[model samples]
Target chain A: SAVISQKPSRDICQRGTSLTIQCQVDSQVTMMFWYRQQPGQSLTLIATANQGSEATYESGFVIDKFPISRPNLTFSTLTVSNMSPEDSSIYLCSVAGQGVGTQYFGPGTRLLVL
Target chain B: AQRVTQPEKLLSVFKGAPVELKCNYSYSGSPELFWYVQYSRQRLQLLLRHISRESIKGFTADLNKGETSFHLKKPFAQEEDSAMYYCALRGTGGYSTLTFGKGTMLLVSP
Candidate 1:
């Protein structure tokens, strides 16, 4: 399993503002996933960030609203643009294990949109 | 559509008592099952996976493909085992993204 360091563990943002969350892995990884866990809601996949290319967004999620960046194999970022109150949620980054699809998640970034 | 269902939103039990958390899934193909735990203020971590067939902290889950279920069970519940448990399934979808259930909160009392 790989270790992920996520910054801005918790944040308070205003409506229409954007927040960029960063995830840095200790070692190179092939795939990095982004998920959003809203209050009292199940975790939902936002996108898959592939190294050196644009992210592949999930259904109902677009790159314009939830843009992603994977500059290298060890780092990725997700930006929530034009945020609204409904965007308040815990955003997490995960890395898949080698030889298996088991993923290890980071201590999520809790965002409160006001 | 792929989905994972955990019937119980909350489960309570006393120490030394047996415990079982039910989970069911709906997918067209065979899916890998997993249990994830989140302790107070901690990150969501994997507890066990059906493929591994291994027990961690005395917890195990058997995948019953015939029933389309994977229920986590432990012989004797401990206070430290209290946490939010989520049942997830990895289907044949692209990238095998995990589809998680709305977790169940377990409380083990003395």
Candidate 2:
């Protein structure tokens, strides 16, 4: 299992502001994914970040809203742009293990837009 | 569309009681199921997977393809088992992103 560390564990941001959450894995990985978990709701996949390539965004999520960056195999970033109150949620970063669909997750960044 | 369903939002059981957290999936192709747990202050982590066919922390889940169910079960619930459990299914896309269900919060009281 990989140990992932995400920065800004919890943050309070004003509407119209943007926040970039960093995810650093202890070891190199092939794929990293970002997810959004609204309060009392299921997780929704935001995008998949692969090194040196454009991310694949899921339905309802667009790069203009959630821009992603993957500089290398062990690091990635997800920026929630022009945040709104509705953007308040827990953002998690995960990596797919080599052998299976099993994923390891970061501690998650809790964003509260006011 | 690939999706996961966790029917119970919350389940409360006494210690030593049997517990079952139901999960169901909808997918057109072969599906891979996984159970992830999040303790009070911990990251969401994989507990077990249907493909591995192994039990973790005495919790077992059987994937019934015909029923599209992969319910998590344990014979005896413990206080430490209190946590939020999420059932996830692999999407058919390359790299196989996961589609998680609304988690079930299991509160095992003594």
Candidate that scores best on lDDT: 2
My TM-score estimates for the predictions, one after another, are 0.97, 0.98
C-alpha lDDT of residue A4 in model 2: 97
Model 1 lDDT tens row, B8-80: 9999999999999999999888788999999998888889889999999999999998999999999999999
Off by over 4 Å in 2: none
- Candidate 2, after superposition: displacement of residue B50 in Å? 0.7
Model 2 DockQ class:
high
Best by DockQ: 2
lDDT of 2 by residue, B30-82 (tens): 99999999999888988999998999999999999999999999999999999
* lDDT tens readout by residue for model 2, A38-98: 9999989999999999999999999999999999999999999999999999999999886
Which DockQ value does candidate 2 get? 0.87
- lDDT of model 1 at position B26: 93
Backbone clash count for every predicted candidate, in the order shown: 0, 0
Instruction: Supply candidate 1's per-residue lDDT for A86.
Output: 97
